[model samples]
Target: MCDWNVDPEPSKEKKGRLARARGNLARRHSERLLAELYAGGTLRARRDASAVLAFAVALVVHALTLAVTAGGIWFIVRGWGGWGMVPGALLLALGWSLRPRFRQLPKDTPVLRRAEAPELFALVDEVAGTRGVDTIVVNDWINAGVGSYGVRGRRLLVLGLPLWEILSPQQRIALLGHEMGHYVNGDTRHGLVVAAAYRSLITWHYYFEPGEHDPLDEAATLQLIVDLLYVVPRLLVLGVLTLLDRLSMRASQRAEYLADRVAAQAASTRAALEWMDRMLILDSAAVTLGREVNRTSLNRPRGKQQTDAWAKGLWERLAADLASVPEREHERLRRVGALRAHSVDSTHPPTHLRHACLQIGEATPPAVVIDDERDRRIAEELADARTKVALQILQDGY
Candidate 1:
């Protein structure tokens, strides 16, 4: 017999408290680990610890989900044709509903071959040194990242053509080195798995999420009852997942610092610093440029020649803006802190901190030369592809 009349509020409260305590403990442990890494712990030590923790959590989650699913099925089989079957069937349905779905890496973006962009490939090789590269993908956004894809876990380097157009040759080298650093430090390998696990947990929570119900509605009573049955457990699960995500993010930040050190070593420290500052400057400039492009309908290019000319003009303007910035103003911009401090979920450390870290280490001179001809050739090769992506963005009204 079930005690349906019994109040569930007390149990809910207890679970809430337990979840909060666990979250706090996880946060504290993560912060302590981060502090140790910053204070003097080796990057490999911190990385290995975080990777182990993430893999353990992921395994536990998958195992628990499988057990619940199997138990539900067994109950259904044993309790067939009776009132006992109701609970078994319900449990089975819940387990199946919350099962994690397959997540595929994005494949819509254009892929560039080494033969198509030999100069760009040369730069990548120069920056990466002995590191192996599976592919280089070019997109239209002002972002870049290194990712592992497919069952064989091939490493892919995605570079934004717009970002490439703006950066000087030395800055480009620094950017490549920083991205390759993620691969070198094993951030790409372990971080991707942890991220996928975190995302799956979040997705599962949202799958069974209850919608808002009006308190005055006749069905509100039943809705409230269902909420009591469902929401508390979901919240507890989500809280734990959130805590794990925070730990993963802490590891990601440490990886960023390590990658920055690698970048500084591979490229000049000055180049790395300048590259970071350029990101901030470019972000601001991009906003203004976007508005102007929207107002002028820059996407409605009459022909390839027109598009190429407009792109060239846009690059010239951006370059002039970057070149005109006074050193003192750049320094001032660096000193002014962000309005909101980075939360535990943030993957990268603050730009100022990254700059300071780079300053600490001795750096080799940038291997790539600042050749305008090479930059021009790379830009020309990517111009048509960038134009197509830009048109798609405008068509989507983004």
Candidate 2:
């Protein structure tokens, strides 16, 4: 396990108190998670609401379509029950589309044997211990290759690539603290509950229809009609779900704050902040480069001769017309497009805001724990890459 020498000046009593407080919070969070998971009725209610809303709207649409086709208001009531089949088809499609992602709890024991880093395991044990919960498994494979901080099997996965390339030991500790916070707080169960609710919503119309309407019915035309009628209700439900997801994200972000506090309590606030910054930097770099690499591979130069000719002519023109332009000006021209893209579509609410949240009330200037020299160099490199990208955008007039 990795070792740290805490500042001896801070009394052991204070550390003990913070540890106790952190444990209490983790326990409360874990309990809440378990409650949410086991509370299937609540999820059923949400699902029922979605199904009823979709069916009612679709049923109305079907009635209107029949009324218009027959060209008589009196026929609407006579054939209204006939339109129930349309809602049924939509219900079937919805059920299929919104099926729960996982059927059973994922196990993590097998993943632990493959994990290479001893330090990460130690950190995980420490965080789990603080919550008074013993983890059955820690997954090693899923860390950097996919999204971070997700629950899978019975194991908590800390991606190896992200840990190895992006984080220092302190940052690694903070990252582990974040994941453990999710586990301790019962994020996995809440996630499953939400998924189940969504699934149940899709299947709701089947139960409410007047006659037996099969969601698994094979009639293409009937299904299409139902699908068309269900579109509005589907959109409405999706919009609401999107809002809920955003709310969940907000809650998750706050949980991140608590986790950071936990990590800081065990270690240092400065360490927590440093880890956050590094994660942002590494993630930004990965997204940018990963996009470009994927694009390049997919767009392998199919027309080499024509491209070469165009490139040669463009270079000659640039050399002749912009020879005296400064490197900074060229760089600015390249990145203008990427800057616009970042501004409009970025999911994260600015890095500085995240950093500020972590440093709510600490000493005058927070204690430094990591290597400033190396971090600055990495930052400079990333900035330079961004500058080049900006210049490319500018030259392209994007």
Which numbered prediction scores highest in TM-score against the true structure?
1
The per-candidate count of clashes, in order, stands at: 0, 16
TM-score each candidate.
0.75, 0.42
TM-score of 1: 0.75
Off by over 4 Å in 2: 1-97, 103-110, 114-119, 130-153, 185-190, 198-228, 242-250, 283-350, 363-398
Q: What is candidate 2's TM-score against the reference?
A: 0.42
Candidate 2, 1-398: lDDT as tens digits: 21122222322333343234333344343334334534531111122343344444444434433444444333444446687545555544544554445533235222332234333344456655543222223222213311223345344343433233345556655656555555444232145454455344434433322343576777755766767777676665555434334334333434444555565654467766665545433334344434444544555445756444433333233223333445554343223322221111122223344455455566223222335664454334333223333233223322
Which runs of model 1 end up more than 4 angstroms from their true locations? 1-50, 65-108, 188-192, 208-210, 213-221, 246-250, 298-308, 318-329, 342-345, 368-370
Candidate 2 whole-model C-alpha lDDT, 0 to 1 = 0.41
